[model samples]
Target chain A: MGLVANAGDSRAAVVDRPGAVAVAAVLGYLVLDLVVKLSGISVFFLGMQVLGGSLELGSLLSMVIDGLLVGLAVGLAGIGLSMTYSILDFANFAHGDTVTAGAFLGWVAAYIAAGLGTGAPIAELFMLNSGRQLSTVSTFVPVLLGLVVAGVGSVGVTLLVDRLTYRPMRAAGNISLLIASIGVALAMRYLIAFVFGTQTSGVASGGLRITFFGTVSMTDNEVTLLVVSLLLMLAVHLLLQRTKLGKAMRAMADNEDLARVTGIPTERVIRLTWILGGGLAGVGGYLLVLESGTISFNFGWILLLLIFAAVIVGGIGSIYGAMAGGVLIGLVDSLALIWLPSGLTRAAAFLVLIVVLLLRPSGIFGGVTTA
Target chain B: MSQRATVSAEVTLPDPSERLLAIRNLDAGYGDLQVLSDVHMDVADEEYVVIVGPNGAGKSTVMKSVFGLTTYMGGEVVFDGTDISERNPDEIIYEGISYVPQTGNVFGSLSVRENLEMGAYILDEVPEDRIEDVYERFPILRERSEQDAGTLSGGQQQMLAMGRALMLDPDLLLLDEPSAGLAPDLVEDMFDRIDRINDDGTAILMVEQNAKEALRRCDRGYVLVQGQNRYEDDGSVLLNDEQVRQDFLGG
Candidate 1:
């Protein structure tokens, strides 16, 4: 809170003339810093490499790719969070658990589908203990089936949760709803732990790797994540732009009172919002597991903060902003390894978030609402 | 036209069969705080009625009460013979009435056509012809159909808000302060458009802060002071009455 006050105070002081000058100076310094570091040129008087001896070209490229891979997942997950915040007007803490729920439900379905008639008991398959190696190439059908189940199952979970919790508290203030969501989040996280056990386990195998033009290389899972995320993102874009329900959602977000006066069924819109947000969170979680080749009971719970950082950075209520913010935070988190240790990368991503808030306040698309 | 200079105490209401909207001794307010009392008024079929008064006169509240936005403390709001005093806004909309609020009337983030599309959301399908009709009435909106409503000028936004309300083609249209923030030049243009809409057979129940101009144009005018009806008369009679001039029109 004090940090926010100080940032706001400094912004007020630099309100008119010197603000532009200060911004330009800071931008100029950063550009120079980037040029010096990327070229690997050492400023001799300072000793040591300029910015820790310019990174190896291949390593830097790989770090960027890794950042994008993580960022895409974060962005995909953040979309649901952003949509709910815009329309429902609350930060749903249970969203992270919804992601976890999607992964568990999806993986179980995938296992059951893949191991059918393979002499494995249904109980073992349900427990995902068939001991079969799953990959994009080896079990393509199962992986695809898992993605669908993740989305659909998550939608069901969110709708049920909304009916049980949020729907009843619909008339409450934002702060009260927010607190209720925290309680929901805790219950969901532990319920998943109890059901799936608390251990992290390997869930996928490296199926294939494609080297593009003898230079860039990517795993088959990474390719799958990229393609699926892009397609889903595109689908969301079309839905918002081309569909009636999508327009009604945006209109309701813009003005709920006017929407009601115009005869829009606001309750129905709210239900659809949960469905969309929950489905996206679930699909994103499954994709994250597919790319990383592992799954844990609380992976989504832990990833929630990073997803939040991405959403806040992008502009909390804007879907496109969440995507852009996710990629930025992802790149920064991975690229921070060039200067800071891997353990501090999360802190670096938060630092970027703070800087963005200080500068733009409303975020990249602030005041623009949910477009 | 024969009922000229009728004071609030002896105001004569139209026959129930001829009335499109009839509010009888309606009392309403927001959540426990009453703002209106015994407010009786009527808008017959295709009639243009305006309610004008000073700040806090509950002029807007009366419009809100008619549309089921305010708390129904007592009395009844009958529209085309349906008792909608306790109905919700969604239910009231289906009763052939549409309301445009004084502020935040248009969906700022939505495109022009999208805003119009949302106005017709109660219908299962988008009425493309209604969109065409709204566009015809306000050609500027058609030119900027793809643009966000937020980017429009104040006058254009007012037109869009009215256009959105017109999407349902309701028999009674409630407009709350249509010329509230418009430029002096554009105010007359807005009033002219309202005249054409009324001419095309949509009865208008409007509340306006510009009392004199509203009285000058509407077929009938009601002067509401402190939430109660003070005077009800033909527009010109209210415009010329000495008592109304002194108390409201600034003699």
Candidate 2:
């Protein structure tokens, strides 16, 4: 008992060092935040101070805290997302689209439910019923419904891609597999555009806001997105770590031929992998739409670079990397807008990706090394 | 070699009995390359049959063809009264024949117990005591029940492969090079286990490179050269035969 306590103390001390470092980092960010705020170069500074920083500790701390939180989130998301790619050995280019689709579905469902109560037509409720307010229960109902709908969509697309593209190109080798994935990406892009149109559509209806610590305030939409993403991530984490199916999935990913000869039913395991991967992608898309308050054909496509950057930076096959990568990218993109031009923030995420790849090609977490 | 053969010709032939597995006029190969031709052999019930040949003499090919892993152009493999020449490997396994391949035969990533469980994957009900019985035979396996098969030594892996085959409770077990790459002691122990398996009522059709040792422990044996059956006799007769010893038995 004493030894365990000592070990726990050491671990806690290690954790505290990072926390202290984060505090120092945030303080440094606050200083930068103040310079931007005082210069008044852009009206965006007002929003930054309002949305991004703390007053007493300065903008440096705020920025650092922001970076750290974003890093942690990206790492977590990256870990979750990479499990799919690492296990399946397939790059799901349509994953971002799946997330957007889920968010869009949630938005549509919420709008419809709001509309039904107001006795408006379905089209008007979805398109222009901006005044209808939903109860908390009603607000969450769409999220659940959206998740299921998006999950189904993700699975369908994954199966379709497997049957139509992956299975055939697998024999053709890696280059062909890559080309097929590109083809799938293009098809998904055009299909989404054809169905949803190429314009940004507002999904969030009310100006719901909540304040935390007198400085950090979040909208209901943002809060929902964060909470749902975290919950989904947790569920996936448990699924991968605890279940028999999850063990089978990991075993299959580690060595497929071994799994097959061991009578693991490779086909079933493959199908389940696709389902889980697609479903997670769907949830990610839904969160994207909710947080952004808009959906367009190119939205997911535009976000693909950021998502890939997150997945790669965290680790190719490591699930923890995906989660960490997502939040890190989000926070970096958010904070990079403080210094660089808006157009350059997206490029900054990619830049981080390239630099990380150069430094550690296997990612922050190690990927499977092919002998 | 000729003088050695001439010195030991006074061996009598033993009568053949009820056939457990019979291969006739077998012509099998991989993609236009004829490896085995007109191969004829039979294993009787409760008998241990060993095939001895030099490397690349199509010994493994014979085992593979019987296990339905190789493509055969012309052949009939009757196992326990069923014609199984065209059957799939899994079907052959289900028809009471278990095959242990020469390389990568067991699941390396799985625990020893899991590998054994997989052996009985085709069966709806694998008796719990079968695992205990196998453990009793291989106490080392029981000690490392949860250890991955990859972590085991070569001899232990061979034992695990044999034990896995026994899990299915198959009537016939096909082993390809059971004694290959083993320490001399392990080889002798493996031969003894083969004898014990035969004693336990499972017909073993093994392809071995250890000609003298394998033949000495088997009930019957076959000598193959260039994929054709060159000689067939009781194990003891073949072990002492002058011509057989000179031509193929490494005399």
Candidate 3:
């Protein structure tokens, strides 16, 4: 009994100690410094290197830009995922596949429009591999039109999925819904593979490079990705903060039963939630492929793991947390290439996620609900 | 319970034409699990009715069934003369009734004002006058209008929940256990607020755990047991009844 008492008292003391937190922070900083040292850049402090100087200045800037591009897409996509989780009460496994569907269809639309009158086989153009050079700069109208189609297409698909699968099981437990989502995920993935084929293919080409901060230069597609991501994020923010539907969504997320009795049209709000989430997922998918100039049947599936890490790190069910977490994960993963193997950057992102969780289990945004 | 046979519970029953809500032979539950049997109850326009009983007596179930939250196994729930028995909550909102659950009654993440805005979500525009009225009713909520509902004290949250329900200015309000988690001193204050709302002409159908106070305050009182109505009468009659006083009011 005395031993238990001593341990509990010390445990409380340790938890309350500010110095322990400081030590953890310092250790994290030192580890980051060590990782930076493993890279090639050079910097010195007191005749020894203890800070960043691993990559070329231009290379560093370019990586930052790349990270931001990836981050914005992930953040935008994660918003829909987070909203559904908060309101619908489950992690939608099909969300990643929803991304894939949007990208594949958006590319198909763009290819058909751009390759029209080029004498390419209509079959190849329709399948999105006619090789007709489809960069945003050269084919602005088709690309822009494709982006809109992506958003609308995903909403239609998501609503259909909800009506068919999730809606009937609304009264079911979260685990049951989660399992259903996993089934939805596998089916959607296989369906996309069946249509688009398994081979990874290139889409956009020859981007127009523009200067950033007088040091780093960004391609036209990158600029498009950044602008579109920023605008979408802003729009989502405005809709959630200023609109009645957004408040209803938040209210439902907070307490579905209470929302019901409070005269909120809960089913209608649920529909709105899917539309917003599905549209964002679709737009995010399109922007991601545009930024990388590459598309594959299962690319979105693979990207889901990293996106989960970001959402978990930021705090699941928090819209702002998902966005902020996406940026953080993207920055860390991209920047870690200095100290980590290119392939191991994803691992490093997960490690950061684990560390964040160890410190705050509810996540940085968990308690904040849908806000 | 031995005095159950001698109880005179029909005193001061309202006329059918004057009632705001009428539940006839209500048999409802969650999913396929029935929690309420054939139960008949009514709330007249501008009347204050309180249902009090022991825990798990299906008091809250009655409120849930009235709001169309639970599964309607059978029976009818007509509100303000509309047959709303099979209507879902989305359709029920148009019937001009509001419910406040015991827990999670407020949208924790939304601000007090936002919570009120959400109450009128079915409306095209936010009713500024209704919001102002809520603020006037709960002045502390007015001071904390920008604060998140989750951050509020239990009593404040209760006030905000009631205020949100009042945003629609409904003909009837179904409040479940409004004083459940309140501090002891604040319980009477919460009751005062409900009285004021009733005094303003909104018929209130409330379920409460504090039987004595609920009976003392309301115009009518109901005692339910195991999903069935046990007693129904004027509040004072129930308060003075020997069986009710001993079995429910903890004599």
Evaluated with DockQ, which candidate comes out highest? 1
Clashing pairs in 3: A41-A53, A41-A54
RMSD of each: 4.2, 8.3, 4.9
Residue A41 in model 2: lDDT = 38
Candidates ranked, most accurate by lDDT first: 1, 3, 2
Q: In candidate 3, which residue ranges exceed 4 Å CA deviation?
A: A1-53, B1-15
Complex DockQ per candidate: 0.78, 0.16, 0.72
Real contacts recovered, all predictions: 0.94, 0.09, 0.89
Candidate 1: lDDT of B173?
A: 96
lDDT of 3: 0.84
2 or 3: which has the higher TM-score?
Answer: 3
TM-score of 1: 0.93
Q: Report the C-alpha lDDT of model 3 over B1-251, residue by residue, as the tens digit.
A: 13332224444444445568888778999888998998878898899999988898899999888878889999888887788888887778778888888888888899988988988888889999999999988999889999988999999999998898888898999999999989999999999999999999999999999888998999988788999888888888888888788888888
Residue range A18-83, candidate 3, lDDT tens digits: 454554656677566655754755578799966865556678778888888898899888888888
User: Which stretch of 10 consecutive residues in model 1 chain A shows the poorest summed lDDT?
Assistant: A1-10
Cα error, residue A212 of model 2, in Å, equals 7.2
TM-scores vs. true structure, each candidate: 0.93, 0.71, 0.90
Candidate 1 displacement at residue B16 in angstroms: 3.0
Q: Model 3, residue A71: what's the lDDT?
A: 89
- Misplaced by over 4 Å in model 2 are A1-114, A119-138, A165-175, A204-264, A291-294, A298-371, B1-18, B31-34, B123-127, B180-185, B193-195, B241-250
Model 1 Cα shift for residue A55 (angstroms): 2.4
